[model samples]
Target chain A: MNILIKITYDGTNFHGFQLQPDERTVEGELNKGLAKTLNKEVKIFYAGRTDRGVHALGQYANFYSDTTIDIGNLPKVINFNLPEDVSVVDAKYVPEDFHARYDARLKKYRYVVHLSRYRNALLLNKAYEYPYKVDPDRMRKALSYLIGEHDFNSFMGKGAVVKDSIRTIDKIDVIEEGDFLYLDFVAKSFLKNMIRIVTGTALEIGRGQREIEYMKEALKMKKRKAAGPTAPACGLYLVDVKY
Target chain B: MNILIKITYDGTNFHGFQLQPDERTVEGELNKGLAKTLNKEVKIFYAGRTDRGVHALGQYANFYSDTTIDIGNLPKVINFNLPEDVSVVDAKYVPEDFHARYDARLKKYRYVVHLSRYRNALLLNKAYEYPYKVDPDRMRKALSYLIGEHDFNSFMGKGAVVKDSIRTIDKIDVIEEGDFLYLDFVAKSFLKNMIRIVTGTALEIGRGQREIEYMKEALKMKKRKAAGPTAPACGLYLVDVKY
Candidate 1:
């Protein structure tokens, strides 16, 4: 049977979501925990991969398991085997051939920026502290240029190798709550580090370091150097995946 | 000159807010950082001492310092000396003798209880996971019995030394947001572990383990065992102190 599971992780101690030989990654931990709970070596497919130090509140995965454990108690039993930084929050039986990656329709990501003068210890590895003054309205204008379908080569991370750079952005929103600015991005998919690079560019415009039109010019140039620096991975969160 | 500083800490690693002979503590870190910044040994007067694993978002402290560093840059310079789990967010000049503990008019504390069946990794040491069903309305009914001035010996923590057990409670609010329940306690002061005990007892009523009138009976009993168990320190937060 194919079992679908919803997962959440802190991601501070994880190398990334992919399986590596020796690093502590989210996928590696999930595999270990699921194998222990199911009493067999397990292979899992995830909805998408999140980079190192990027959190997830609603990451999804699917695996084939013939265990006798009830679906209602699967999350709890699997949680007992998982570490404190990761957990299987929910589980259900899906179609025998269901795939977590191929069946996803849309993905939502959130990036948080703290606009405080002093660093908050509670948010040490949780948020990016940008001390400079910024106007969210300026960022919204810059972000408008990146909406819709485009080849986001300039926004892609340096080492990412993708055959196609064209992707559709469903929506982009800039929201202000307290001293933190939240940037939400929705798309069917994204190139590696695309959202982080977009965030960095929008922040530059928000702080008056660059004009809003720079985003359009950078996208047109289609070169990595044309975009701003990549934002830190600590501020990013995979908010949800729509199936 | 006396300087007042606002502090924030994650509180996951420290032994508590008090200075100990051989333990990592918030006060110890503050003294160490202040001494490093001022080039002299220092002692600080804090608003109140929080127990181990209890966070603080708006803790206050005062100390005498004649450092040459400007007050505007004091927090930043001091933060450079402190560890990653503690930070000084603000600093200012105060009167010659302003005590953080004595002149305080009110204190506000917040306790978070997660009602979700699965534990959240992002809130591992930040909230309490009950995993059981609870009704906020039932908890609120029990909390109302705790309002007003009372001799709260039943709610006091073990090994606390104090001359009086009487404290005045200004308000008690149980707020429900998302899958988490927030209990806000306001008072001139509180007995040690008072809020935690109240929360534990209220949760019992919320989960139908005890009657709503149990709170009034427990308060009148004036015995330690009359109240419920103390909630975990990780679930508590010193929200603010008002003078």
Candidate 2:
């Protein structure tokens, strides 16, 4: 059977989502738990890779297995072998050729910025504490410039080796809840550090340190240095993916 | 100067809120941070002590310090000395006779119960996952039996050394948000493990394992064994202390 599993993880202690030989990674741990649960060597395909300290609420993975365990009990059974920070929330039989990464879909990501004057201990490693003054209206105006397809070279992270910098951003929503501001991004796929860079630049605009037109100017520059600083990975979360 | 500080903490890694000789505790970390920030041998009086794995959103403490640091910047200064899991959110000058514990008018606590079919990795150590089916109406009815003044001996934990078990529960609110249930308790003070036991019993009522009238019967019995099991400490939070 081809099994597609839904996952949720707190990525504070993970190096990232990809596998590493010596370092701890989400894929590494998932492989371990799958091995222990299935009692066999199994290679898995993950939906996407997240940066270090970036959490995921609805990451997906797929693998082939011959186990006869009840489908309803799969998540609980697999969770017993997984660590507390990561769990398989769901499992289901999918088309034999379904691919976790190559299946065409839209992805939603959320970046949380804490606007409180004091750092919140409860939100440690879960949000970026940006204590400076900000206006969400300014941020919304700045973000409007990035809607639709664009060459995201200016927003891509340094050391990225992607040949194609063109990506389509379907929408960006700036939501304020209590003392935190949430930036929700919907896209087919995101470039490395694209959302973080956009968040940083929008924050600069929100603070009145940069004009609203700066976002458009930076995108046109087509250079990483033209964009604002990359926001920390802790504030980012892979909210979900739709196939 | 007499300073009153409001704190927030993630209690997963600590022994509890009280100071212990060798165990890592919230009070130990607070004392360490306060001493380093004030540069003096400082003693603090906490509003209350929470059990291990019980978090605090607005825990308060008071201390006498002669430091000249600006009041507005004190939380930031002390936060630098504290670990990531505990933070001082606010600090203010108060009268010398003020006491964190005795001067409190009421206390509020929240107990969260996760009712999902599967465990949520993000809510690990943050909620009690009870997969059994539950009825909020039944739980509410069970909770109503404990309102107002009561001798809560049946709900107190083992090894408690208090001479009196008489306490007043000002209110108990049963709130359901998504797949989680929140029980908010308002009282001047509480017996050890009182909320957890009440939650466990109420959950039994919610699941039909026991009838709603069992709650009143247990209270009247005034014996610890008459109540249900004590829920885990992770679901409990010291929401705030009112002065």
Candidate 3:
């Protein structure tokens, strides 16, 4: 039977979501944990391939195994052995044809920024510390240019080999909660580091480092150098995946 | 001149607030950082001597230093040398008569509990994970029994050395936000682990593990053995100190 599982992790300790031969990764640990619980080898597929130090609140994955373990007990047994920074939030049996990666309809990403002089001790590595104050009005103006479907090649990550660079952004919002800025991006999918690159563009405009027109120019040029630098990985979180 | 400073810290890495020759402590790092920046030996008197793994959001301290370092630059210079988990929130010059401990009027502590089956990756050591659903109504009722002045010997930590066990509790509030519960305690002074012990008693009563009258019985008994266990240190935070 095919199984679907939701997970949450800190991601600071792991290399990334994908399995690596030497370094510890989220997929490696999940595979090891499921294999031990099922008493056999198991291969899993994930919806999002998050990068290193990128946290996740609602990451989804799937696996196949023939076992007698109850759906409720599967996560319990697996979580008991998983590392402290990672956990299986939920686990259940899906239809035989259900696929975690292919069936995903929407994925939500949240990038947090700390806008303060001294960094918050409790939020170290949990947010990207943007030293200067950012104007929300300016940031929103820059964000407006990136909304809707477009070829985001200028925002695509360097060295990411892909056939298509076109992707649709369903929604983009910039919210301020105290000294923290919550940048939410919802889309069917994203090119590698697309959120961070887009955020960097907005941040630059918000702080008067770059004009608002730069975003439109970058979108039109479709050149990597036309966009702002990619923001740090620590501030990014794969908040949810809709199937 | 005497310098007053407000600080915040994630206490998971330190032994405690007090200094120890062989162990790493918050006070030790502060002194080291201050001395290095001031170009001389330095000492500090803090408002709270929090236990190991106990966090602090607004801790107060004072020190005597005669240097060219301006009052405005004290926090900046000192904070730059301190460890990543500790930070100085503010610094200013205070009268020589001002004392951090003796002149303090109140101290507030906050204990956080994440009541869920799945642990939050970001709040590992920052919050207590209580799996069972706790009735807040019952907890509040039990908390009502703890308000006002009382000899909290029953709730005092083990190996506490003190001349008096009497302490006045200004207020006790239990607030629930989402899946997390915030237990706020305000008092003039506390016998070590008093908040944790009181919280443990309330938790037991809320969960139906112990009778509501157990709290009063423990207070009347005036013995540590009569009270519930002291909750873990990780969940407690020294929230604020007011003079």
Candidate 4:
């Protein structure tokens, strides 16, 4: 059966979501766990990849295995071999022809910033400690400039190798809860470092280091150097995906 | 000078709050840090000691140092020798007669319960995951019976090393946010494993497995077996101590 699984992982202990030669990865653990449960080598597919230290609250993926594993028991069987940092939240049977990556859907990413002067022990590795004052209202005004389709070449990092720089952003929201500031991005697809770069630029504007119009000017310039530094990967999280 | 330091720690990585012969502890780190900065061994006193795997968000402690370290720089100096899991959030120079343990007027403990069917990856070892359904209202009702001055021998664990069983609870509040239930306990002091035992017993009453009258019966009976099992240390946190 082709089984689709929803997973949540703490990426602090992982090198990244993708596989590396010697380093431990989320995909590596999933492959190992799947192999043990299916009693054979099994390949898995995922919705997207996260950078090092990036967490995931709702990441989707799928795998095909020959066994009569029931839907309710899939999570238990796969988790038997998985570690504590990685866990399967939901599992279901998908069509044989379905592809997890190619499926048309919108992805939602959430970035968290700890606005406290001191770091929090309870939220270590879960949110980035900015330690700087940022006005959420100003940040929201800056986010409004990127609500529609645009070439986000300025926000894309230099390490990104994507040929298509144009992506549609359905929504951008800045929410504050307690000492945390959350940035939520809804998009069909995101270029490498797109969300982090936007967050960094908006934070600069919120700090009054840059004018609000800088966001529009940076987009028109289409230069990575014109944008702010990339935010830390620890603050980013793959929160949801809608198909 | 008597230095007052407020600390926060993730106890999952340490043995406990107090020092041991060889094992790592919060007091051991403080002593090491203070000794390195002051160029001499310094004894550290704390408001209370937490069990292994229990965390602290606002634990108070004090140490005497002859070195003239600035109040603003003391946290930095002490944290230099400490581990990543333990951090000094606030530091100040207090009067020479001030004591962290004896002079405290109130101590507050917070216990978190993740009321969900599955474990949360982001909160591992930070909150207890309870799969079964529980009624917070019932638990609060049960908690009211244990408030005020009472002899808590029935709720104290077997490892308790205290001569006085009578303690006064100033306040008890139960608040639920999202999928987590927070139980805040305020008291001048507590016995060994007292909060955990009370939490476990109250949880049973909340689950309807036992009646609320069990709380009154347990206190009058003054037997450890009369109470419920000791809850895990991960969910209990020393959140606040006021002098």
lDDT, residue A153, candidate 1: 93
lDDT of 3 by residue, A182-205 (tens): 999999999989999999989999
> What is residue B67's positional error in candidate 3, in angstroms?
3.7
RMSD values, in order shown:
0.9, 1.3, 1.5, 2.3
Find the 10 residues in a row with the least total lDDT in model 3 chain A. A116-125
| Candidate 3 residue pairs that clash | none
The lDDT values for all models are: 0.93, 0.93, 0.89, 0.87
Q: Which of the numbered candidates is closest to the native, going by highest DockQ?
A: 1
Model 1 chain B worst lDDT window (10 residues): B140-149
Positional deviation of B211 in candidate 2, in angstroms? 1.4
Candidates 1 and 3 compared: the better one by lDDT is: 1
Residue lDDT tens for model 2, A1-243:
999999999999999999999999999999999999999979998888998899999999999999998988999999999999998888999999999889949899999999977898989989999988899999999899899999999999988878799999999999999888999999989998899999999999999999999999999999999999999999999999887
Chain A fold similarity by TM-score, each prediction: 0.99, 0.98, 0.97, 0.97
Q: Give the residue spans of candidate 2 off by over 4 A.
A: none
lDDT of 1 by residue, A1-243 (tens): 999999999999999999999999999999899988999988898999999999999999999988989999999999999999998888999998889999999999999999998999999989999988998998998899889999999999989978989999999999999989999999999999999999999999999999889999999999999999899999999999998
Candidate no. 1 TM-score? 0.99
List, in the given order, the native-contact fraction of each candidate.
Answer: 0.76, 0.72, 0.43, 0.34
lDDT of 2 by residue, B1-243 (tens): 899999999989999999999999999999999889988779999899999999999999999988999999999999999999999888999899999999989999999999988898889899999988899999898889899999999999999889899999999999999888999999999999999999999999999999899999999999999999899999999999999
Measured on C-alpha atoms, candidate 3 has an lDDT of: 0.89
